[model samples]
Target: MIVAEHLTKRFGQKQAVSDVSFTVAPGKVTGFLGPNGAGKSTTMRMIVGLDRPTSGSVSIDGRSYSSLRSPLTEVGVLLDAKAVHTGRSAVNHLRSMAATHGIRRSRVDEVIEITGLTSVARKRAGGFSLGMGQRLGIAAALLGDPHTLILDEPVNGLDPEGVMWVRRFVRHAASEGRAVLLSSHLMSEMALTADHLIILGRGRVLADAPLADIVEQWTTKSVRVRSPRAREIAEAAASDTVSVTSRGNGYLDINGATAAEIGELAAARSLPLHELTPTTGTLEDAYLKLTGDQVEYKTKEVR
Candidate 1:
């Protein structure tokens, strides 16, 4: 397990992270989410002792990462795929890292096969493509077979199959009772992979809860209706309390009202209804809603 209490960091005049506190527990995949400049990288760096915290503490299991005699065996991390020695072959690079903690050569071969890097194992890392670099990074992280894993943008340059492999790898790791803290920009993949979430914005913790709870809490309940008289039904249902959105094509979404309420309203108005179904927002919807005000960069138009 990983525990962070009152973790904070600052670079010169800019505050990167502020009084953040959360736990990445065993047997679960806790997703880390944030917009650019949200301080996620700094926090992960502090966890692995790469950067010093301005205040507060972070520990692996029950001890600080620096205090561990065998840090590799305790925790594995993949913060950057391009951090490896560019001139070294993939095999040589893994060998050097494995040698740090006396990991055997068989394990090196194992991880090479596991990450599907055997084809390019003897190739210079500098020559590897972005997707291949990501695979190499993952192989290094798993070399120790540590009890905990911390990965940042593990699927950034991966193909569809590579992405699926990561999803399966993290899910399988968590299933084996390993603590996994993952950060990614792919909301759809995160929704499918994470059991819990820790969302950060502007360098502070905005949300720490189960995936379902975060989605449910940030999103309002809404219902979908299909009918030729959708505009009419929506107009009839609209009031000071109810909200309606016309999607065109005889489809509309109604909020602040239940499906039964809308159905009854349509029936009373004598509007022929083709469909009336209750629906909830997806993870992406909930994330956008939760971080709408917290976005650091805004586009001129979504289109």
Candidate 2:
């Protein structure tokens, strides 16, 4: 498990992260999400000892990252896919990383095939494409079979197949009781992959909870009603607590209520209803609403 308490970072006069605290538990995938300039990269950097925090502390398991005797075996990190030597072959690079941790060559070969790097094993790192480089980086991370994994944008340049493979791989790893933390800009993918979420805004944690809880708490549930007496329904339902709006001719949108309530309201008035569909909020909806006021750069509307 990874635990961070009162984590804060400052660069001269600017504060990048402030009193941020969160936990990435074992046997689960925790997704890190935030808008641009929300200090996600800085937080990840601090976790692996890349950037020293101005105050507070973070630990993997029970010790700091620098205190670990064998850091690679305890936690595998892929913060930058391009950190490898450009002149080295993919196979040689993995071998070199393995040499530091006393890992065997068979393990190196195993990760190569696991990450689908056999075709480019002998190819120089500089010649690999963006997707291939990502695969190679993943191979190095998996070389030691670490108990914890931290990947930033692992599927950034992957194709559909590669993306699916990564999704399944992370799920399988978490099932084996490893702590996994990843950050991505793809909400649709994150919704399908992550079991929990840690959302950041303005260098502070806005939410940290299960994916379902985040969606339920941050979004509004609504019912769509269609009938000849739509206007009548709207007039009856309109109040300080409930909201009703007419969508053109025969449709009424109802909020702050349930389908059963709307149906009972229509039945009491002897109104014939054609449709009554309830829509639950999704992860994307919750994210947009939660971070709506926290965006730093707002786009101007084109007239």
Candidate 3:
């Protein structure tokens, strides 16, 4: 397990991260989500001891990363796919990393085969595509067979197949009782990949809960109705139980009203309905709603 307790970091006058505390447990895929410049990278760097925190502390199991006797064997991290030496072959890179803790070459070969990079193990890393580079980084992370994995944007440049492979790999690692902390900006991907979510905004945590719970907290179920008699329907359903809004497309968006309730009302009024679609907001919508105000930048249309 990885635990971050009141972790805070500051660079000069700007605070990059602030009082962020969370636990990433074994046997579950925990997603760390945030918008650009939301302190995600900074927090990860601090956790791995790449950056010194101004205050607070982060620990792997029960010890700080700096205190680990065999750091590589205790935690595996793929912070940047481009951190590898461009001129080095994939095998050479993994070999070098494994050699750090007296790990054998056989383990390096095993990771190469596991990551499906054996075919191009001899190729220069600089010449490889983004997807291949990501795969190589993952291979290096698995080289130590660590009990904890920290991956940042693992699927950033992956093809659909590669993306699926990463999703399965993370899930498999967690299932084997490894602590997995995955950071990504892709809400749809997180919705599918993560069992729990840690949402960050402006260097602070906005929500940390089960993925389903966070979604439920931020989104509401609604119904979309399109009819020639939209005005009449709106008038009849404008009670406190339902809130109606114009869809700006000759339709009405109704919240807090179920399909059955709307259908029954329409039937009683003898209103001619063209469409009645039940709509539930997705994780993306929920995320947007939660972090809309905390975003660092916004683009406004010019007049």
**lDDT of the candidates, in the order given:** 0.94, 0.93, 0.92
Ten-residue region with minimum lDDT total, candidate 1: 294-303
What is the C-alpha lDDT profile of model 2 across 1-303, one tens digit per residue? 999999999999999999999999999999999998788999999999999999999999979999999988889899889999999999999999999999999999999999999998999999999999999888887888999999999998999999999999999999999999989989999999999999999899999999999999998999999998788888887889899888888988899888999889889998889999998888999999989998876899899
- What is the alpha-carbon lDDT of model 3 when measured against the actual structure? 0.92
C-alpha lDDT of residue 96 in model 3 = 90
Stretches of model 2 off by over 4 angstroms after superposition: none
lDDT of 3 by residue, 19-59 (tens): 99999999999999988888999999998999999999999
Give the Å shift of residue 88 in candidate 3.
1.2
- Residues 1-303, candidate 1: write the lDDT tens digits: 999999999899989999999999999999999988889999999999999999999999989999999887889899999999999999999999989899998999999999999999999999999999999999998999999999999999999999999999999999999999999999999999999999999999989999999999988889999998778898898999999999999999889999999989888878999999999888898888878898888778866
The C-alpha TM-scores of every prediction are 0.94, 0.93, 0.91
Better of 1 and 2 by TM-score: 1
lDDT of 3 at 168: 94
Best by TM-score, which number?
1
Candidate 2: residue pairs that collide: none
Q: Which one wins by lDDT: 1 or 3? A: 1
RMSD of each: 1.7, 1.9, 2.3
